[model samples]
Target chain A: MAADETAPAPRGKVTITEIARRAGVSVPTVSRVVNGRSDVSPATRARVEDLLRLHGYRKRSAALPSRAALLDLVFNDLDSPWAVEIIRGVEEAAHAAGAGTVVSAIHGRSGDAGEWMRNLRARASDGVILVTSALEPPLHEQLRILGVPLVVVDPMGSPAFDTPTIGAANWSGGLAATEHLLSLGHRRIGLIAGPPRLLCSRARFDGYRAALEAAGVAIDASLVVPGDFHPESGFTGCNTLLDLPEPPTALFAASDQMALGAIEALRRRGLRVPEDMSVVGFDDLPEVRWSAPPLTTIRQPLADMGQLAVRTVLRLARGERPDSPRVELGTELVVRASTAPPAPVL
Target chain B: MAADETAPAPRGKVTITEIARRAGVSVPTVSRVVNGRSDVSPATRARVEDLLRLHGYRKRSAALPSRAALLDLVFNDLDSPWAVEIIRGVEEAAHAAGAGTVVSAIHGRSGDAGEWMRNLRARASDGVILVTSALEPPLHEQLRILGVPLVVVDPMGSPAFDTPTIGAANWSGGLAATEHLLSLGHRRIGLIAGPPRLLCSRARFDGYRAALEAAGVAIDASLVVPGDFHPESGFTGCNTLLDLPEPPTALFAASDQMALGAIEALRRRGLRVPEDMSVVGFDDLPEVRWSAPPLTTIRQPLADMGQLAVRTVLRLARGERPDSPRVELGTELVVRASTAPPAPVL
Candidate 1:
């Protein structure tokens, strides 16, 4: 029973009456202050000013033009620790840029895609930074149509979107991990790769394979187990790898959470890290450094990536074309107590 | 540029086309399924049934009542690791009750209250769980008027609104902390209290004072320092306390983060934990247990509190009076390696 009805829309204006009510002041005094009638005392004026500052109340009729503000942040998952750090970075940058951020968590579930589309349709934000794996076809199409300043973090997009991307050198980090194991004289090594759906996962896997091939080692498919970038999944993957006909002496996990899980699984099986099976993880989250025995992992420049992503998004929002649409931050092999020469075969 | 426009609203009759589109099926297939037409293949029927199960799509024209849905979980901040465990508990309980969650972070500058209000107004969540320390008067009043199921976590409301609250026994926890130090033969005890604006802070302070009074120890105003529940604040507070002429032998920090900060400050000043100054912390967050030498703290039943909050909110949303409006979970003293008898001051 929808029917056309005309009603005078309320103007987006703040009145003296509303301010006085908000500040718990008299309407007459508020009017006098607003109209510059000068009847209000200094204390009253200061109180009103404080109230205005607290509520972000600006006179709608003010002649000054304000800059249009919007921010887009890409997050791996709502629960992911990496996303938390990135969010902090993006938040700080957005606040400095005088804009607001719209965060979206990308998951493997298709329902999230539909929700993402709805969010895009609403145009709730000015630009988007796709944070997950490379954009899926449907999401990329929708984002392109929205036609805002776009930046992809941790995912290098296809030519269709041609947006700037910021990510770490995952492949090189993977190589460094494998090379470390090779230097430790480990003939058999296990690789716990992230989800196949993500390009970073594939890149890291490629690096692992390349390192193995360079060392003249046969790529044993059984040594490579698929993981979901979660600690639970890592534990399961480690168990599966450990139960193999011939288990590897060293393990390279694609994520710190997965590595921690691997360590737990190892411990449960009466295996000590480094002494039994050395492990190296990626992304070096804060907990990784503090984990029992401390994990030796590849350190992706997460904080730097976050700061750069924010700076890039800010530039895009300001109609400034960045010199490069793609940014590949560096990663270092943080040799900690977790990794050592593979122990002699029992 | 605003215009009054209305389109013909869909009627009460559940259209087969609408159901099929929503379920991603053909109209004739939906019609056959609805009418129990004999010509429909078993596979098509099963697919439609599965779709119906997934989307909760029902024939509105039929005299079937709609099932209740999940409630919204409005958290103040999500970055805190403590919030993660709480959320997991809430999520598990809510899922068991056939409810979903919509999480929102509401910590912007004080001026963005109106923006937060607008965001909350646009949300379609059934109820809200406010996991924050302090609620602004205006925002709180507005949320109360929404007439939805509301449960507050941590913050106890003023007598004006009788919304249910679930939290740890903060006061008792504080008393326990002080008593532990007292039992260890420490008369000079210092307190690092949380922000004064928080209800928990006041309750904890009261408990601390009560415990000292019970032990025939005079409360030293100079030994009390204000902390904002952050590690940095804890460090500063500890420094301030340590600088006093008659420094406290044992210190009780209101939160784990602050405790860690205090520990850092102590270590920086070349003092060892428990050896030079005994330390006790509240909220045994995961990292605290893994810190160097670990920390002795009060362990709040975070997960249980989360689950109870979710269940309570769900019941309220169903127009059912919860068995209890207030849930005060207990806190246990986890005597880790952080605290010991004060070293014999020669």
Candidate 2:
């Protein structure tokens, strides 16, 4: 041991041998007490524990108990507002369930699958709730091997694992959004689709096509544009669509944040929402309601989804198989001041 | 074991005895390999490690590794924009340091001190960079008991412990904000303060008082309103001040979020910012820059604070006592379009 406390030491890892020496006990006895070995007598156990505390000797890593008491609340990205709301919901339920959450960021799009997998393997959480669907194949496979009770939220594609999943009826919500514009007598409707890789985007696109077909309006591929489900992407996508020779009379964005951006783009070009271009959005977050014109959007049961995810994971961790392996929660369309009948073509 | 696997069947936890029996070794030999005790052969060590993985026999409650290969970036509130930016900064630094983060939120102001204590006692983190003031007595005492290498950010009132801390130059920031208002020729300026228990708030308030005294302006006790560092509190506090018979011509909020809320409250009463009353805020968060009229704010070195906090905690965890127990960083005043000369008295 060095006398210079402030000196840059190579490393200061305290070992069990040091604790045993300080406690005046055999290494085996110290191990027994640390591991709570039933064979150790009560008197010796107390003495060893006291000594361990005095020397700041923590429990050895190898003696970890088999049962997990903490829960892992996995989010696809830490920066997204949608994830924030869902996390708050999950946190509330987890608190009520007497479980602590270990938050891990799983970057879905950056191709950083190895980093996320390594984290999942290194951190020992009791159970896991996957809150995003954009996880790459390798990371998803790694999670499967993890063998913990798992729950998936808003899963993008088909059910890949035996674990339970909870998600909103995204397709129905898309239909409602498109139908609202159609009911407003807007025959030429354009859609801002989410990333092509995401299942939610595919479903929403399907619903959009279905709505147009049902209304006897020709489905124009040119009216659909791809977006990355971000505000900036929405703004860019809206600008591209609006640049067409005969642009859509109405626009439907898959997310509210994107819709807000679309409004900004429209305003920048001196166009008013609904008056010049009608817009409808999905996921009516609080900020959407506060937007200038108050966005017309679809509302998902985010809080309920969070509660369901936690409950499902807890049930699986407790060795109880839930009745439903896949849950599709409902969504509702909220009409506000953001949408109106398409302006008469001049 | 029971045959029924689906109905909450108890799979008795695998113990060291079972591992020894399966490996065909004595209990002491099994213990030696599991604990990485000296004198264990390589083959025996590998066999024990393989079995441990196969059985998923993790310790129920084990302290984090003494020499952590990763960092734990802890924050009191996860939803705040300021905290999020700081976390992003920590994430970038930790990535550069070849370390990972385990983000855990300690719900402050919700009055859940017991939960905070439990998480601290669990010792799930290697090193803690507390992005909050440990002014609460119970939490302060618990920090002493846990004794993990720690760093406090923006610690208020008194030093919670001898651990290193890093925070913005709150006193200077406060003075800058106040001086900006004074330069705008606003003599009747109101202050929206953070919690009194927090040292940052006290320093900012001291700066506010000093600026007024230095300018030969009399301090009006009635104009000073205290609030929790929350937007809602700011809204309420602003309403109270605005309702006073002799209202101030300007407002200086201690936080940007608070300043935004104050602006909203002022708008509700048909008062325009800078035109009717000037407003100055602290912390130039992204939202502040985009806010209507753009905010004139004091910018704290958020990213720097986060990086320093992580580095200091890691050093302390490695048994190096830092020379300075507290480190005060600096802040800059950013003059945007929010402040202007006050309107003449009605």
Candidate 3:
């Protein structure tokens, strides 16, 4: 210890909870002040610092279970049925843990990173659960210095070595959707795939390829088109596929929204779903069950993924490692009216 | 002044900003301590009070602008496309105003109200915007005492006299939808309506009735069915209509989800949307545009409603009343492929 610095108490002696109780602020605030975050009001920071000094506060020698009273749940966007399911699951998990959740969104605009960090510092959230957003290295370093726990859901890019992540088995899901179509005797199947850059999207595309090879069917480049995982992309992809010399009899879209768009394209041509073209969708969202011909889809356990993310984040917040650094939930085939044997003539 | 209470310097003077700046605390924290909220740490609250004494802070007789750096947005539930549109709108408005928004949900659980109120006080939000939830008198009283401005979006029930509210011209929308079907040579139109408890639902049902009466069509009680503004209700309502001795050739649903359900019901019965039975829906939600036969529906400016709520709340927070206590934005009729001349048979 420096001459002017008092020695920290014995390792594992003073917990964050005790310091927070004495400082008259939330535990996260104490963590923020200790990390030297600048957003905290000066007087509030000074009060928390005094308590830290009096207790001889020091960094934990090892990760230890320290429960937080709150967690922050952030989404890249909240416009889709996909995001709603995830939010519900997180809320349920948080409620069970008796912890409150603060919901936020970072649209990736300029200065959004700074604004988001400032808010997190102000709230002193115990842990952060980010859904479908890239994890930047600078952010990781800042959070590491603050000793804040972070877990990503369906991470956009390859996550850092230490970051825990939760996602569905997209490869299996894609293969299953394609195999179902093959079983329906549709050799010429079209794929409306999500953005090729996303890892999950690439996994799914690979799975589709594997299914074709397993069935001894030749993969045709003309049958596959890229979609941005939205309705318009699906519509445009389907239109592009229809323009091909030999349009596929069955279409498997990487997302439910895309499938709906494909259905719309077929409808415009006055062709009936299943009667003319068999369609399979991924992510059996709530809306699909009520679609004109209830859509057959690969059901990603989205809510389950969300629930697991919350549990993992809570564990991390308590200074414990998750049972696994990467967890992949299962996906299943949900057969509905949208898929069937292709028309004999086609 | 009481012996323990330091005498205030003057009447109608020191602003919340000056007190917050001098005390090195947030304006909301000062507001919370001033209102005797229990959530703040005692030590921090005491320090704030000492500064309040030194500055001789006094309540102003004039409505002074006390800007809260944060705003709170509470949703009755976060599960619907309806809610998402509103959230995006509020976010856009908040972003434009350069204020941070804190999103919350009150699922009508017993303690949710108390918990939400506490979080709001802790954050010291400048204003609160609630969507489709009734305002309880006690909460109203508490917010009023704290001088926090509040605005409701599509209020479920009659609001407190002072609370500003924004909604669409739902009755006009309902009337327009029914009239559009009637103009297409349909006499007996089936109506799938929302819950009776909600004011907006009642207005829409009444609109449907007014259009029928204006056209000299009898108000057949059997033609109108109550739905809960969801898919299942629409399905059930359509089934009920189909069971009637004479199911109407044209159907109008109070919401897009319900309309989708009605279409699904029609498809299950071996019917084509506009060819076998014409269907019209309200709320031109983004999903409906891509529905099998694009739906002709009434468009409620939901995003506009959200934006208006934020603007209204901010105005109130600054101690200004909105131009009107009840602001109803206009609804428009959007023609699409779903409606056409009714099939030649009943």
Candidate 4:
């Protein structure tokens, strides 16, 4: 059963069962010997060992038992300061763990996925953190078989399959945002909704509806304008709501970028914030603090989500399973100058 | 004198002349054979060929003659939207070229240089685009010797070595920014500068001073508060200027970020932009267009700089020298709502 030095054998093609069949031994015996478990008899161990070496079969742990040197970070786009904040958190975590990071923008796979995947494998990245879980299943399987760890942040569409994820309590964030406006005596509140396809978007939207339902306020379709969580979308959404016969007295944008856009739209129409309309935004990005009138926002721990993703993926890379499949961090309400009580009735 | 397979033969270490000596041929004969240049006798060619193969000596073209698949982008830091604009431009250009990009932030080295350099080598990046030219000489030589192409954007200190570089007309940008503020009929103008070590900062500062001198206004050191090109710095600079016994009626910030900071500082102190004081900024970042009152600033064509850097580095990777060692694109002043004639004296 001695193996030839140059047998031209390759791994990843043959499974443990196949090896067991070839060796005329049980699958457990083959596995035991391959893992150096030592429970197998000497004769069987030698036979299985020779077969394993000849076939170039190596367990996932055997290929890279040590920690990986670099982490792969994939994003839907790199256009927003939101991405920068996430990058900052991930970089900080990666730095602390003594690992380097590589960032890729897939943009819904516009054929960039093939190139990015090739580079990831070539780089032998220790793990991967995908900011948006808008990926095809086949690609997920491909990465799984290659033994590269993966973690998702703010999954889009539906929940990903068995992939650990880290995200903010977006529903709670939405609820708290609406409640803040309600406490300030805002009954006629308008909402700029995020993308409908994303689960986080739906959760936040649902939470907003729940708050209104609890307040005994009737749902007004005209007050809810759809947006893509961008400035232009927010601007358009706000303008649409403002054009209504009886416009909302207070507006809640799903994102800070969108809120800023809404503010711009309001100003262009010769309206003032708080005095004319109160606005509250989500994701309390740093730039929002410098926005005119400042910004009252729901603070989603975007950086924490990034840091948590790194930690989760690193754990997976170390061959350890995460404690939970999904981890939701808390959100906070930051009241600044953008929000105020509705103007006194004329 | 033929090399043995296990002779510890370093591929890049041995010289062609050494191969010639071993092959019993003239230096010219060896050179011609290695370069695949004809006109060498078959007998000599056969001898030199055998020696070349034995020693593992191959031309540079023999290795990765194809264009690289990944481009490395290094930044001093990635905290600014300015970086995002540049990234957008480079990513677009790189996508067009079917090349992938990897971004890194050095934070003034922080000992991350070794990790970054190692990653670059392992990935065999086709080229490198450095946002700042503050790299150490040894690291520069290492990249050059490894045949990795390099380009610099907005060189921080000065023009780098033979490496091709892309930069903005920073002096013109500065002059234009200050000139806009001066045109508003303001004699005492505050200046918030960027990092002093960067060449771009020095140029802009010089331009601001020149604009004042040209207007026959004496410079006031107290009115010129130094800043590090961030929002907080701008806020502090504006506050410091506001505290001066003789305050300026207008301000010119070195970057859009600083301008935003100045606006925030003004708003926090119960002041209004343009109505209270005119303001001008350099680097018309995308966010600046959405800033309240928009912004009147110099447009640096940051995205174009990114695109040009990729084209330049790709050319270098193709073994072609650029038309010039340094290329400075133009900067234009964009008149937005932020600048207005100073309020009539009380």
Ranking by lDDT: 3, 4, 2, 1
**Pairwise TM-score winner, candidates 2 and 4:** 4
| Tens digits of per-residue lDDT for model 2, A201-277 | 88888888888899999998889988887787778989999999999888999888678778768866878777899
DockQ of each: 0.03, 0.11, 0.24, 0.25
Q: Write the per-residue lDDT of candidate 4 for residues A88-148, one digit (tens) a residue.
A: 7887788667666667678876477767776565455668999874767777865665557
Worst 10 residues of 1 chain A by lDDT: A59-68
After superposition, the stretches of candidate 1 with alpha carbons farther than 4 Å from their true spots are A1-168, A171-346, B1-70, B156-159
User: Which ranges of candidate 4 are over 4 A from the true structure?
Assistant: A1-70, A118-126, B1-68, B122-126, B145-147, B215-218
Best candidate according to TM-score: 3
- Identify the CAPRI category of the predicted complex in candidate 1: incorrect
lDDT of 1 by residue, B1-346 (tens): 6442232123222355666776578887886765446887888776665544333233332211232243555556655667756665666575555444444455645565565555444332456777864557667655544435678888644424677888789999999999999998999999999988787888788888999999999999999999988777888999999999999999999988788788878866878787899999998876565454568999988878888998887776555678887778998899977788888868
Per-residue CA lDDT of model 2 for B233-263, tens digit only, reads: 7788899899999999999999987887787
Considering every candidate listed, which one attains the maximal DockQ? 4
Candidate 4 chain A: worst-modelled 10 consecutive residues by lDDT: A59-68
TM-score winner, 1 or 3: 3
Q: What is the C-alpha RMSD of each candidate to the true structure, in Å?
A: 20.1, 15.8, 7.7, 9.3
- Which lDDT tens digits does candidate 4 get at residues B274-339? 899888888887777777878899999988999999999887766567888889999999999888
TM-score of each: 0.54, 0.68, 0.82, 0.79
Model 1 misses residue B26 by how many Å?
Answer: 37
Candidate 1's residue-wise lDDT over A70-95, tens digit each?
Answer: 45554545566676566656655654
Interface RMSD of each: 10.8, 5.0, 8.6, 5.6
lDDT of 2 at A217: 97
